[model samples]
Target: MVTTTGVLFIVAAVVLFFFWIYGIVSFYFDLRYRFLPAVREHLRDDEQQARPDPEEYL
Candidate 1:
């Protein structure tokens, strides 16, 4: 005999597994394609380096 609660649990687990996979893939793509480029551009900017290092104040 199939219990309704057991079926519901299985369905929920499958849905959550898909969500976990989607999160991982999206994060990986965002980091590789978007986040890294932005970071590189920011770091390479001359204006940032021209500013006095905040650590010097310490």
Candidate 2:
């Protein structure tokens, strides 16, 4: 006694939920593996450049 619209809605909900989970897992791994390293590298470069010379009148 189920309608076609109900079945379609259920299917769509399941598909969307799977996609949501996939996005979360992908984002976590990407941020951990790629983003953190890149950010660290960028920060290191910043630290290496434009540094003030040490005061000689200490």
Model 1 C-alpha lDDT per residue in residues 18-44, reported as the tens digit of each score: 999999999999999999999899888
* RMSD for each of the candidates: 7.8, 3.7
Clashing pairs in 2: none
lDDT of 1 at 56: 98
RMSD, candidate 2, Å: 3.7
Give the Cα RMSD of candidate 1: 7.8
Candidate 1: stretches off by over 4 Å: 47-58
lDDT of each: 0.95, 0.94
Q: Can you give the lDDT of residue 10 in candidate 2?
A: 99
**lDDT tens digits, residues 1-58, model 2?**
9999999999999999999999999999999999999999999989977686578456
Estimated TM-score for each candidate: 0.66, 0.65
